[model samples]
Target: MRLEELMNEHYDEFNENDLHILKYVLNHKATSSQMSINQLAEACHTSRSSVHRLTKKLNFAGYSEFKVFLKWESQPAEQESRHTEILTNDIEATMKNLADTNFELLSNKLVSARRIFIYGSGTAQLTCATEAQRLFAVVNTFVTIIHDQVEFETMFPSMSDEDIIIIVSLSGDTPALLPQARKLNAKGIEFISITNLKNNKLAQLSPAAIYVTSSPTATEKGAGLASFIPFHIAIETLIRHFAEYLNV
Candidate 1:
């Protein structure tokens, strides 16, 4: 099951804060897997105890044990071994970390939403939104991508408990969208966030998060290539999961 699906399966048991922490972990696990408990707490703006509690809630022995599982789960299979090798360099490492995190997030959740709404801003925003739209379509699912804030609100009233909203951002800190995300949270809307940073404000707001780790764009020519690869891999995984769900 995907992270969303997992959440849906256990939705009634999750409190708001629990959902928030889950989102942060799912979004940033790729990078978080590399961090210590202290670092994870600092990134997520929570306490070490909170992190431990979350791990326990997820039925793990602790953070360290969780990381081990994450590492094992992230390895590529034989067929994709060659492709995985291509990512052996620094860029590959960053992207592989992201892909691993995304896989965990998708596999853990069990979302049964009737509809999904995707939101993105700036130039690449539409691209990300379209990618999600395309992937979700394979499972005969419904999705709406919104570019402007005005249009988003117009459709907000129509959103029900069965609907989901997904937001994508590299910084995990988009000024215009932050307030809106908070507002939606206040309204009890469930959200899945895809972002580059782990503990950023957006991740904090989302109920579930998919974190991508990529090299710095300004530092190297191909630095950001691995960053976007995680998103592509995530969408592909989501599509497969959705297809499996439909078949079942």
Candidate 2:
């Protein structure tokens, strides 16, 4: 797994100070990778112990191991022929994972659920959710789209086993959504996670999960523009299976 993956997996554990240190590291990967723990702490204006704790949260033994991972990410890979080629690879990987996955259980759940709702963790994810809603609506299977955190919290208390939720998230480690995931798990509510291809806390908390491959693009600030095409493909493919299962 990449350093980014490790950080994302433990994202919820990070506090404000940890995030401040993380921001510095992400913005200056090459420099930070070469710096000693003391240098990094000085640069980030935090305590050495704070930096050490951040490394521990990322599952690193210490700063040394964490620096090694950072160095690896900074090393340039052999360039692909084109940006489109990267997306092609992502699609191919996503299809392979989807092919091996059996969607029968999820399709059955959708068919049997009394009410279905879909929520997206971010704007890009919401587009995918909208597509899912439109596709399912064509078959007369109306899906309620949960708009935001407030809406989800309001609806959650009334949700039962007969209801199902489809959560679309890129990292699958969105801090705000994790609490809802835990609530769903504790309440025995059936929810499915559609997340980027990685081991994530949300996927672990859900009853079922669908993984999609995403190609990393250049970062504007700290955010990477990972392609969402795979998400759309996954959603469409899932709905096709659900339609078949519904005999529609």
By TM-score, the best candidate is: 2
lDDT on C-alpha atoms for all candidate structures: 0.66, 0.86
Model 2 lDDT, residue 166, Cα: 96
- Candidate 2 C-alpha error for residue 152, in Å: 0.5
Error of 2 at 93 (Å): 0.7
Clashing residue pairs in all predictions, respectively, total: 16, 0
Name the TM-score of candidate 1: 0.58
lDDT of 1 at 202: 78
Report the lDDT tens digits of candidate 1 across residue range 1-248: 23433343355566666777777767765676777889878887878888787667666789898777655544544443233444444344444545545544543343566677888865576687898788777666768898888988888888876777888787777798898888788777788877764446777677776665543433234333334665565556566765675673
Give the 10-residue window scoring lowest on summed lDDT in candidate 2.
Answer: 1-10
Worst 10 residues of 1 by lDDT: 217-226
On lDDT, the candidate that comes out on top is 2
Which residue pairs in candidate 2 collide? none
Q: Using Cα atoms with residue i matched to residue i, what is each candidate's TM-score against the true structure?
A: 0.58, 0.68
